[model samples]
Target: MAKQRIGIYPGTFDPITNGHLDIIKRGLRLVDKLVIGVATNPSKDPMFSLSERVAVVERETHDMAKVAGVEIDVMPFDELLMKFAERVGADIIIRGLRAVADFEYEFQMTGMNYQINPNIETVFLMADPRYQTIASRLVKEVARYDGNIEAFVPSMVASEVVKRVNESKV
Candidate 1:
C-alpha cells in the first residue's frame, strides 16, 4: 500500500467563496488527505467569528467531505502556517493562484515557508477561469452594501454573510 500523502490548504476563508471550493476540490487530487487550515489572520478584521468561520466551511463543504474518497478535515489553526503544516504531518501546502499578483506574493511567502520548513513543499493551483475574479474582500464589500452574493458563495454562506452584516448594523 502507498503511504498517505497529507496536503494542507491554509487560509482565512472568512466566508469561503466558490473559488475557494474550486481550489479545495482540485487540491484533493494531489494528496490522500486534505486538511483545510482556517488560520487567524491578524491583519484583517473578519466579518465572521472564528467559530462562525469554521461552521461556514464545514456547512459548505459537508457534502464534498462525505462523497470524496480523499479524507477531508477542516480545523482552525493559530500558529505559523509552516509550523501548523509540520504539526499536521503535511507533505505539501496547497495554494490557489488567481493571477500574476497572487504569484508575486505567494512566491515570497513560499520562499520563506521553505526556509522555515524545507521538508514541506508548496503547490500552486491556478484558479478555475470562472472563479478567477471572485475574491472574499470584494464579496464582503458587496455583502455590506446589500448587493447580491448568491453567485459568489454557497447559498448557506450567503445567508450567513447577510445575517452577520445585518446584525452588526443593529
Candidate 2:
C-alpha cells in the first residue's frame, strides 16, 4: 500500500484566525492527511493557554467534514520543529506566507527543519486576499484596544478573546 501524504500545519495559534483556517483548508486539497499542530512557545506570552487554544481549534474545525478529516493536536516544544513533525509522522510542513516578511522568516525555518530531516518539505501557501494582513498578533492587538476582531477570527475564538480580555482586567 502507498504511504499517506501527511502534512503538519504548526503554529502557536494563540488564537486560530480565519487566515490560519484559510491555509489549512487550502492545504488539505494537496495532502491526504492534515495535522494541525498547536505549538506552545515559551518565548512568547500567549493570550490563551495551550489547552485553551487546542480546544478552540477543535471547536472551530469539528463540524467541517473536510477539516474533520484533519487531525487536531497540541504540542509544547522548545527544540527544533522538525522533531515535532517527525513525532507526528508528517512528511510535509504547511506554512502560510502573507508577505515578503513572512517568507523570509519561514524560509530560514524551512532550511533549519530540512537540515534536521531531509525528507520533510515545507510548503508555503499564499494567504487569501481577504486575510492577507490578518495575523494572531494583530488580532490580539486589535482586541486589546477594544477594536472589533469579528472578521479576523472564527466566531468561537472571537468570543473567547472577549472573555479573556474581560477576565484579564479583573
The C-alpha lDDT values of all candidates are 0.91, 0.82
Which candidate ranks first by lDDT, i.e. highest? 1
Per-residue lDDT for 162 in model 2? 84
Candidate 1, 1-170: lDDT as tens digits: 97789999999998899999999988888999999999888687988878888888877777786677788889999999998998889999999999999999999999999899899999999999999999999999999999999999989889988988899899
Question: For each candidate, how many residue pairs have backbone atoms clashing (under 3 Å)?
Answer: 0, 0
List ranges where model 1 is wrong by over 4 Å.
none
| True-vs-predicted CA distance for residue 120, candidate 2, Å | 0.6
Give each model a TM-score.
0.96, 0.92
Query: Candidate 1, after superposition: displacement of residue 73 in Å?
Result: 1.0
TM-score of 2: 0.92
Candidate 2: list runs displaced more than 4 Å.
65-78
